[model samples]
Target chain A: MRYTSFTSYDLILLAQGLGVSVALFLVTTLIGFLIGTIWAVMRFYRVPLLTPLITFLAELLKNSPVLVQLFLVFFGLPALLKINVTPVEAAVITLSGNTAAFIYVIAVAAIESIGRDQIESARVFGLSRWQILRHVVAPQAMAFAIGPLTGLLVNQLQVTSLISVIGVVDLTKIGNILNLRTLKPFIVWTVVGGLYYIAAKLIALGGARLERRLRAHTAWKGL
Target chain B: MILAPHVPFLLKGALLTAEACALALFGSLVIGLLVAALRTSSSPLLSRAAFIYVDLFRNIPFIVQLFFFFYGLPEIGIYIDAFTTGVLALSIAGGAFSSDVIRSGILAIDTGILEAAEVSGLSKPTIFRKIVMPIALRTSIRPLGSVFINLVLTSSILSTITLNELTGSAKIVASDTFRPFEVYAVLLIVYASLTYLISLAIGALHRRLNRDRMPDVA
Candidate 1:
């Protein structure tokens, strides 16, 4: 008996795929956010050598294809470094690095959005550079950056799907597998695409809510 | 174990990348222009349908759309080769993005200009072709260039559909030469350099086309 019918096991495969995707997204987002913020801070302090280098690196990362980045990490690293790397590990590293490069640019822009006069005034009031960063720049930059940061996170979530190319077995890969086995492109792809659509919408919704909350302090009050 | 001897083979892949990107660029320009017109048309139905097309394609992953065309088309008795399928997919996806850019370009036009064109009794199609398109194309050259660069990067996905484009051909050499590191590293540089050159060309084109209107553009 050839097992050609839609089986209950298919649902389990899909759930597992979604779980993989969510797990990878969360982990990469955290790592990428940290690295990107550090890069931005390196630029913020006007570190002579490192700032230019990070800018160039981030630009290179932003310009190239993410697929190429995946190849570099997943395929290139193992051969060059003489180490074993699981698909998941490669996905995490590649996605995080790519995300960080973009986030670094946004953070730099957000930091620069603050007026120099404000920093100068804060400095005159006996605020150290570190103190100004912590107490002054950080809060305002966060408020300004949150909107763009949310956009980046949503884009990064979509980007995680590219990891399926390297055999991570995310939702896209699961869709591919089910498509091949069931020979049901419409049903399999529709359900798969529908799942992705809903997830993307949820991310957008969450970002909007976060943006509203973050900007609540600046909201206009009744006279 | 080394790839020095295989430079010519890899160059062939690069040539394929160049060819596919050129063709897809032209294809996308056509789709983009049509969709942009539809989007900015007086007909609500046409505009709404165009908007939906753009939105749906933009939101979905390109790979899914690629597979849909690559696999689903054959099932429905439309037989096109992998190269054609890849080009079609890239054109469609690029069309969505380019249309967005071009639509805004059209919207940014001054109504007084359109009114003057109308006062001259120019036909709608002619006005669209002669005035609106020329202006929109000039203004949107930069965004469209980025869209085309994206199309080039996206052309990599076509490798999975069995088209031996740049990345596809690189995969073969990677396995044959057993130098995945150098191959992909080189491929990444190739793509980055390709896009950089494209953006530079776009900058020049933007300057040249808007020379008469440089004050505003600058």
Candidate 2:
């Protein structure tokens, strides 16, 4: 007889999948944030050739589908470079690059949202460029970027589902396995989608909380 | 060198992609219009229902939704080919996004103009169809363009469901030539340039449509 019925071990399998998805999401977001910010900083300094190059790379990443990127990395890279790349490694690289591209855009916009006058005044005040960035630009940009960053993070979490196609044993992959075994796509996908939905909501909630904290100083205060 | 022979095959896939995107775009615009209308309607229940749809579709990953429809539809006795299912899925997902854009466009309509329409004795549906939609769509052309661009990129995922569009056909070329790198790298550039051209066209269209209200609308 086919073991078509859902069992307790299935819960453990799902939890494992969820763990992988969440862990990968967190790690990639952190790496992407760092890489993307550095790219924005390069642009801010107007690094001669690098700024344009970074811009081109960001646009390429932004316009193309993540699936193609994943395929290029997972399937194409090993063959081209003659290197061994585990699925998880390929996923990490692809997702981090994708996330960084988006973050770079958001970071640049947040920086531009700061007025030129503020930077000029900081310069007039004998503030160093670094100080001007840290004291004047970073704080406000953080506040400005948090909203978009939150939206990006939620979207990135969903993008993680694409990695399942690359055989990452992510929540979607687990759902796929269960689906084929049980032949019940509705129950399998709903549960899987629901888990993703909850995770996205949590990211959104965290982002909102962070945004409120970042914007606290700007909130109106009683005289 | 190896990819040259496969150019026609890839072009065929591009043609399919173009056809699917065109049909899906039309389907999405209609669904978006209706959803946006419901979302902005006076009835709380209608608006709430629309809101839930937009929220659910927007939050959930598109692949999951695609899979749900791909697998679930057959179970419910709705037998459709992969192309049909793919287009239907894209339309629904694209509708959620386009609806959001159109709804905002609707929301941005000046109250004075709406009041004037009311005073002119136009019926609600007439005011909506004649006055509201044109202004909203014109104003929202740029955002709608982005939504459609996203739809194009998202179309690549249809390959997973076995539709063999541009990305899918590229997959075949990759395996056939054992040159996954060249095939996908070229595919990436093609997609990026294609989207870039689309955005350029959208910008021109936006400028031409809103020419009368130039500087303010853009």
Candidate 3:
């Protein structure tokens, strides 16, 4: 007998899917953040050959669809390198690289948003380059960067859904499974879309909170 | 080297992609204009309804939205092909984004001009069409271009629903040639260059249309 009804166990299945999605998003984001920042710093220091190369790579990644990039890593890389890549591993690598490319663009912009006069004055204060960056640029740039970073994070969360196309059993994939099993696309997809919507809202909320905290130093306190 | 034989097949797919994006772009512009008008209208209820539409569509993933229409429409007995469904989904999603752009453009209009039009005794629709829209659209050409470019990139997702657009055709070639790397790598560069050319064209169009304005504005 084909049991096509929605069972209570499906709730647990959804929660597990959500957990997988959230975990992957957080891990990839952290990795992307570090790699992106390093690339930005290399540009800042004018590392001779790598800066232009990094810029081109970031531009290429940003311009292309994330789905294609996922395919490249998941299918293309394994076929080319003659190695097996599990779906989850492919999702992680692709998402992280894509995220890093975007973050690098934001970081470069945030760093450039700092005025040259401030840096020159800091130099005259006899502070070393690293010290100037640490004390002077970092705080201001963080405040500037948070707004765009928040937007990027929310977008990256949605981009994570594409990994489902490649067979990772994340929330979307779970939705796909339920969608087929129950043959109820409306109910199944609505529930799945609702989960993603809530997650995106939560990330936006967290980003706003962080932005406020970062800008606290600039907020006026009335006497 | 291996991709040369498949070039004609891939071009056919790219033609389909171009057709879908072109139709969707026109559809989106119309929807965007209407939504922007509604959002900017004096009626609070209409604006609120429009706002909810934009918010819901924007917050949800495009693929989710696509599937909602793709699958749900069939259930409701609408019975459209994947191509029609993909275009409809793309237009709706693109409308949400372009509406935001157009709404901002509308908001940026100078109050003096509206007041002058009011004093000239033009009807509301006439005033909006004659004065507001032209100015808003011209100023926002650059942003609208980016949104269209995004629509192009997002068109690749239509492959999932069995529509053999550019990305879909590339997938077939990949499996057939057993060279997923070359196929996808070339596909990626093709997409990047296509968008780059579009951006350049948009820049020229913006400059041409806005030439009468201040130099900085152009």
Model 1 pairs whose backbones collide: none
Off by over 4 Å in 3: none
- Give candidate 3's error at residue A198 in angstroms: 0.8
Task: Give the per-residue lDDT of model 1 (tens digit) for A92-120.
Answer: 99998998998998898889999999999
TM-score winner between 1 and 3, please give it.
Answer: 3
lDDT of 2 by residue, A1-223 (tens): 4599898899999999999999999999999999999999988888899999999999999999999999999999999999999999999999999999999999999999999999999999999988988999999999999999999999999999999988999999999999988889999999998999999999999999999999999998879
Clashes of each: 0, 0, 0
CAPRI classification of candidate 2: high
How accurate locally, in lDDT, is each candidate? 0.87, 0.95, 0.94
Error of 3 at A222 (Å): 3.7
Each prediction's TM-score versus the true structure:
0.95, 0.98, 0.98
lDDT of 1 at A162: 84
lDDT of 3 at B193: 97
Q: lDDT (0-100) at residue A117 of candidate 1?
A: 98
Prediction 3 TM-score vs. true: 0.98
DockQ for the candidate 1 complex? 0.64
| Native RMSD of candidate 1 (Å) | 1.9
